[model samples]
Target: MQVTQNIKAPEMLIDYYKAIEDSSARMLEAAKHHDWDEVVRCEGACAVLIEQLRYRSQDQELPPEQRKEKTRIMQRILRNDAQIRILAEPWLAQFDHPFEGKPQVLH
Candidate 1:
């Protein structure tokens, strides 16, 4: 008798990636509308998701097939991040311009 099978990959890892992607999408929407507060909120959420993903990755490895999927997801995430930064640079410069000559307060 011969058996052919592949071990199943853990679903939790995929879930974490999905959650991060969702957060990035939300951030993109917020950035489009110039809603920095919402973007920051989503950014915080993404940070937490990243920490969770890091912890999960220490113990779980994706299957070979899923590796491709993970790569695609990561690419989308990077694209979202790049666009967000592009949208934010001018707004950030506006903030910086006002404080350039102000006295610094040390706390």
Candidate 2:
């Protein structure tokens, strides 16, 4: 979608937040596979992409109705990114540190 110069930062921030999860997934996967190189590469890529979205994304945002979508874009993206990060963390941890102890059910 094309954005005008007036686009809001919050709206763009949502997308930037979202890309975090996508990037984290790649990081987690690479870690899972013992591909530390790939993990590092993905982290760099993700950082750049997020920076671009946060810093370079621009569009004209005007009219409440027109701005709604961008607003929603930001909200939804941020939410997704957070959830994905939550899930990815444990997965990444498991990959990074293996336990030789007997598995115990927490619940």
Candidate 3:
């Protein structure tokens, strides 16, 4: 017989936060390696996870203990994002004038 385990709502919400933190870490790693493509992929993953977290959070509230852990996870994610932005600054500067001489069209 196969058994399945059901996670509680608060736990599930923490899991989403952990997943997002993980994806943000990966994005930072990719940025450090100058792998913009992988960074973008990880960023997309983080976006999806964020959306899922928002949806799951609609009716779920974490308990005090889990809230502390979520705060830690959020802090890590923010740190990773800060590092990634620093790493990407040079690469992003390349697009500073991408449309400098292009004509603008209003729709």
State the lDDT of candidate 2 residue by residue for 1-107, as single tens digits.
Answer: 11112212335454554455566655656555656666667678667766676564555324465466656655654664465466457657876757646596676
Candidate 1 per-residue lDDT over residues 1-107, each given as its tens digit: 11112223325788778778888888888888898888888888888888978988999887788788888999999999999999999988987778687898889
Q: Estimate each model's TM-score.
A: 0.80, 0.40, 0.80
Local distance difference test, candidate 3:
0.80
Model 2 per-residue lDDT at 87 = 49
How would the candidate models be sorted by TM-score, starting from the highest?
A: 3, 1, 2
lDDT of 1: 0.81
How many clashes in each candidate? 0, 11, 0
For model 1, the superposed segments whose C-alpha errors exceed 4 Å read: 1-11, 100-107
Residues 1-107, candidate 3: write the lDDT tens digits.
11122222334788888888877877887788898988888888778878988998899887788988988898999899899999999999879977767998889
Clashes of 3: 0
What TM-score would candidate 2 get against the native?
0.40
Over 4 Å off in model 2, which ranges?
A: 1-12, 56-107
